[model samples]
Target: MAKLTIVASIKVKSDQVDFVKSQLENLVPITREEAGCVQYDLHQDNENPAHFLFFEIWESRELWQDHTNNDHIKAYQAATEGMVEEFVLHELTHIA
Candidate 1:
């Protein structure tokens, strides 16, 4: 099966950027430790401090689904629910 990829673009409130960044940083190690996670990285937009991106790669779609159900992920979602201005999630499959 092809690998699964997720691209999440988040726009945070200007006053909440630092706090949001910190929260996202905490998820990095936890995500990396998940069984089927290949990569889970957080990136900030060079020109826009309020914008951030999550680049995730998983062994399969099933694994990605599992990730969303994980306790830590659930907590993260709840914690950031109202802190973000906008959030977009995109799923992709390896092309080559």
Candidate 2:
């Protein structure tokens, strides 16, 4: 199976940045602990703190799917409900 690359951008409400960032940071260590997780990084935009990014790599699409269904992931979805103003997901493959 081919490895997977995910780039997700989350635009949170300007006033909710700290709470959103805390919630986002909670996902990192847990996701990193998952099997087949190559990398799961969180980044905040220097210019716009309300904009956050997730750069993830998984061993396969299946593993990435597993992550999406995980309980923590579910909780994240619940916790961030409405706090997120916009979200974009991109699934990718490395050429280099």
Candidate 3:
């Protein structure tokens, strides 16, 4: 079995950056505690306050899917509804 890595890129409305960041911050600890979560880190772009990224490593794709279905993640989606301008998820298949 191979571990899966995911990078979630998000851009929030300029005015809502701080609020959205706070919401994202709350998910970090909770997500890190989930089963098969090898690493879950949140990062904000140094120059673009509205841009946020999440780097996650999971034991398997199924486990990562489970994490996405968790309650806190749902809450995050609900809370940030229209505040998010763009949300893109990329699954990285590390080569080398």
**Clash count of each predicted structure:** 0, 0, 0
TM-score of each: 0.94, 0.96, 0.97
Give per-residue lDDT, candidate 2, residue 82. Answer: 92
lDDT (Cα) of model 1: 0.91
| Tens digits of lDDT, candidate 1, 1-96 | 888999999999999899889888988999899989999989999999999999999999898898889898888888887899999999999898
> lDDT of model 2 at residue 81?
92
**Which window of 10 residues has the lowest lDDT sum in candidate 2?**
1-10
Per-residue lDDT tens digits of candidate 2, residues 1-96? Answer: 568999999999998999989999999999999999999999999999999999999999998999999999999999889999999999999767
Best by lDDT: 2
Tens digit per residue, CA lDDT, model 3, 1-96:
778999999999999998999999999999989999999999999999899999999999999999999999999999999999999999986556
Residue 40, candidate 1: C-alpha displacement in angstroms: 0.9
RMSD of each: 0.9, 0.8, 0.7
Please report, in order, the local distance difference test score of every candidate based on alpha carbons.
0.91, 0.95, 0.94
Q: Residue 46 lDDT in model 1?
A: 99
